[model samples]
Target: MGTTPLTPGLAPSPGSDGTGVVEMYAGDRASQALGIVVEDFGEDWARCSMTVGPDMANGHGITHGGYLFLFADTTFAMACNTEGSVTVASGGDITFLRPSHVGDALTAEGRAVATTGRSGVYDITVRRGDEVIAVYRGRSRTLPARPAPPAAG
Candidate 1:
């Protein structure tokens, strides 16, 4: 299988549209297990939400930092891959602003800040109602498309 060439601002190939991206991400077991939902998305932007539950809480009865990072990362992935490229996180950092309690609904909004060559930068904000819970910055690198698997008999 040949890799798709990188084209800036190009729509993703077939099955890579906004809805397709959401559908493809639905196969992610970890995200699904965490109850992450892709609420809405467009070119260079995405919004996702997840509710804090007991399983996601830490010893102090607050939402764990890892869960918050995962939420931001998922949103970043959706925002960067909107252009049809197979983008992966090169690096990321997060700052926890406040503790989130169980039953709190967390929403992560990610937007692309810059895209140069095959690399891009994105920022995500996790919020509970009007309260900011966390902020995340992610760097992404676009990789060549993976070869398709051989057809089944």
Candidate 2:
């Protein structure tokens, strides 16, 4: 953490339209706390954006790798969970191509590469406008649907 927290004005917060995305983001304190917004999404893809805050900067004065990974991962989560099943990352990897700074608006877009037998592979690209900042590839596992609780009388 650097100089700022999730203050006001990081408007149009995550997922205000899609039901699954909305629900997922609604319970996602991490993404919300970072002020990520869901720009658009479809069956196997999602696009999100966030502006880097001072709190996300690293000792080198650029945005931290963890924050970049988190942004990409959040977009991946949105893409993989659009089918209405709870999915979680089994593992993921990211490569930083360029550095982003505080106040830099970044966009993370993810798309499913493959899926089979409850496992999925997704690739996420993080960009500062037209510049590619990072690329993330994630493996996910979709959990079995939980049984509903007992109905009330």
Candidate 3:
């Protein structure tokens, strides 16, 4: 599959909208191949969903492990990149519980687990229907706050 471009926190610069640019990257395309779509974006959370298909399958005809990781990663990025404090993933760990297969509609959800100064932690969960397929924990560091944009001349 393709990779989805996770939005990187923008630097503090004049005229910056505060919220960094949001774009779909290679990993997103991979998620799209699995039929994934970001359904919601919020202050401290993000939700993504995808329908499993043959294109998402590995040699064994099940959803590939990478796909699951991407799903959690994307959600983690979204949750960490909050307003005021820019977030970057410093580390993460994921655990797979069961195999997800074709025809399963999987949803990845992420939430803030903890925060300390410029660093924050997020938890991500991947589920098919009501079954939890994977769980992930991500650590992120927020850069120093940027100054607001200067007024135009």
Candidate 4:
């Protein structure tokens, strides 16, 4: 498929919220079901986070791989679509770096690395504190921009 390029100094800051893009992504029921919050949303990048609780743990009490994947994927979705159009990931792969534990707040950030025509590549990183727990590369397809509706009569 496609590949994601890396952005220099790409990272997420804390305490920022309510951005229209973030709201479009994380304010949905899917994000709420996963306990995720979008902390930052920018034209070229996006970030989301969630608390690793008991409910997210595997039999060994460690955060499950699926949770990490979803977090990274969600961030990927937001970053790719931050330009105010619908974006969908067509393919993705994630690498686990370290295990996450209960009570650890996990954050995932994504940056658009490259785009060709209607396809885009995104790089996603999942972190706990300063430690990276996972890294992902995803490809997205951007839908055609929609036109504004006619004014009311």
Top of the candidates by TM-score: 2
Question: Per-model C-alpha lDDT, please?
Answer: 0.81, 0.84, 0.71, 0.76
Best by lDDT: 2
Superposed Cα RMSD, model 4: 8.0
Instruction: Tell me the tens digit of each residue's lDDT in model 1 across 19-93.
Output: 535455746677767778777677878788888888889999999999999999998988887766678899999
lDDT of 4 at 53: 68
Collision pairs in model 2 = 2-55
| CA error at residue 52 for candidate 2, angstroms | 0.6
Superposed Cα deviation of residue 8, candidate 4 (Å): 27
TM-score of candidate 3 on Cα atoms, chains taken together: 0.71
**Candidate order by decreasing TM-score:** 2, 1, 4, 3
- Candidate 2's TM-score reads 0.85
RMSD of each: 8.2, 5.0, 7.2, 8.0
TM-score of 4: 0.78
In model 3, the runs with Cα more than 4 Å from the true position are 1-35, 145-153
Report the lDDT tens digits of candidate 4 across residue range 23-141: 46434666667677766666757877788868889998888998888888888887876655677889999999899998998889898889989998999989988998899999999
Query: What TM-score, over all chains together, does every model reach?
Result: 0.82, 0.85, 0.71, 0.78
Per residue, candidate 2 scores C-alpha lDDT tens digits across 1-153 of 221222233332244234556678778888878888777777778888899999999999999999999999999998887766788999999999999999999998898899999999999999998999899999999999899999999
How many clashing residue pairs appear in each of the predictions shown?
Answer: 1, 1, 9, 0
Candidate closer to the true structure by lDDT (higher is better), 1 or 3: 1
